[model samples]
Target: MNIKGKTILITGGGSGIGLESAKQFLAEGANVIITGRNSAKLEAAKKLLPSLIIIKSDVENEEDAIALLDKVTSLGGIDILYNNAGVGSPALNLGIANDQILKNAVYEMNVNYFGVIRLNNLFINMLKSRKEAAIINTTSILSLVPALEEPTYAPTKTALSFYTRTLRKNLEILKSNVKVFELLPPVVATEMTANRNDKKITPEQLVKALVSGIKKDQFTIRVGDTKLLYVVSRFFPKLAFNLVNPKKIYASLK
Candidate 1:
């Protein structure tokens, strides 16, 4: 929970929430190492934050994940592994038969869910060895209520949300010191959501809330509209569904 003096590795840290996270964590006095698939983006991020340790790697690749672990281990290990990399395919109607539907679902699941598991499995032992360590998984508000517009993307987060919760309980039962934290963020103004006109929080605002939550040792940190959605979904499932998948979204799809 102590950000100061701890080293953290964040995936997909070239821009958006990940980059903002690197900035805030650095300001908090933590050593930050960032990884992304784009070499140019990594270089740009390094230029922005001269102290950041940038590595070019893709979360979906097994070889890349292994190499990343070796590289991080050589750098003296990390106290936190922040899984922030995620992807979504273009909006498509799942009611119609289309090959893209399955393809999109697989791609989202690979990066958003399995990728987190791969990295966590590789680093769990190292994290346990640390005096204090944590694993942060970024799920979405859609994980609580599915969005019709983001059919595949929403399901991926839902699966990850379940995995994260189970993983936390499993670690606790084993008496492990490694802390698992699930961050459920609402729509944020990022490259991924650039096309959306929906209201969004800035990356800075989201990361500020995240860091504050981590410092307070809050495992499930819900930000912005996510907090409200959680409460509503618990009591009013039908209304929560309507809030996420409005009538306009259905009309647009049609």
Candidate 2:
């Protein structure tokens, strides 16, 4: 899928990865629409990237997703739907209390899973009608391997990975032109994980890899340590799993 002149809807556009994606897409001359729950954040994005179409939305809410898709598609045909909106919560292995663990799991699932689901469902038809359409889902290294924070985030990515795959399979069954893609990005120097020194890749490097994978030919856009996770997840599930356990391996959050 060509990024130039294409219209793309992005969720979680307030800050971090989502915001960065919006800026990069705009620079590439793609018609970008960004969504977030905070009006202030949306306004801030607008201030920073005036070319962007900003929408205040909570992708976790089904109705909000439907409304957002409707609003954007009505303006013009949608060529790409980048489901970049996501949340990361502490995993049960992080050893938080039971109540916090439950809340964390739910929060992560709501933003990471259902948020993408709602957008995919609503805009799929519109994208199908277009000449060429694509979907880019934001997954993580934990989806393929366990991280100390895996319990909170890995399941959501695992679920999302399956969801994207099934959708692609269904598209084949229906003979649809929509191509699906995923990113297994390693930790980046973003606000969500700025403290980490283990990861050397910058968001620009990751985003560059992302744009390179925007074409339909790309499937899994794995970069940096993320690829290692797949290898580890496959060859040494238990050993790989233990490495990220906060209790057993490293309790240090930073």
Candidate 3:
């Protein structure tokens, strides 16, 4: 919970929320390591933050995950694992071949779901041994309220949300000090939403809220409109579903 003096690892830290989080945690006196597949972006992050230990690694690759553990172990194990690496589903067209759809879905799951599973399995024990530690998974509000636009992407988050909840409960039963936290962020102005003119919080704003939430020991850190979306989905599932999938409603209205 305490960010100071902690060793933190943030996947997909090359940009967006992950980059901002790495910088914020570094400001709080934490040893931060950021990993991504893009060497150019990682290099740029190093130039920008200078203090960040940037690693050119892909979470979808098991070998890269192992290499990442080795890299972090050399710097004294990680106290916080931020599972932030994720991919938005490719544009889904019903006209596309079924094989292509399946292929796209597999890649998305590999990075979004299996990546979290692998890293958690690898470093959970090390974190448990530490006095204070946390596993933060960056899910989305779409997990609670599915969006019509992201058919493939939304399901992955939904699955991860449940996985994180079940993991938290299991940790509690074992009386483990390692905390599990889910970061459900609303639409942010990132590469994931480059063209869309939707309302979005800046990555810095989300990171600020995230740090404050973590400090308060909030297990579910909902950023911006996500907090409202979560509540609506909880109390009014049907309404929430309709609200998020307005395009679907319109298509059916005729």
TM-score, one value per model = 0.99, 0.90, 0.94
Q: Worst ten-residue run, lDDT, model 1?
A: 245-254
Local accuracy of candidate 1 as per-residue lDDT tens digits, 57-143: 999999999999999999999999999999998888888899999999999999999999999999999999999999999999999
lDDT of 2: 0.80
Q: lDDT winner among the candidates?
A: 1
lDDT of every predicted structure (CA atoms):
0.96, 0.80, 0.89
Better of 2 and 3 by lDDT: 3
Colliding residue pairs in candidate 3:
none
Tens digits of lDDT, candidate 3, 60-143: 999989998888888889999999999986556545456767877788899999999999999998899999999999999889
Instruction: Count clashes in each candidate, considering only residues at least 3 apart in sequence or on different chains.
Output: 0, 2, 0
Candidate numbers, best TM-score first, in rank order: 1, 3, 2
> How well does model 3 score by local distance difference test?
0.89
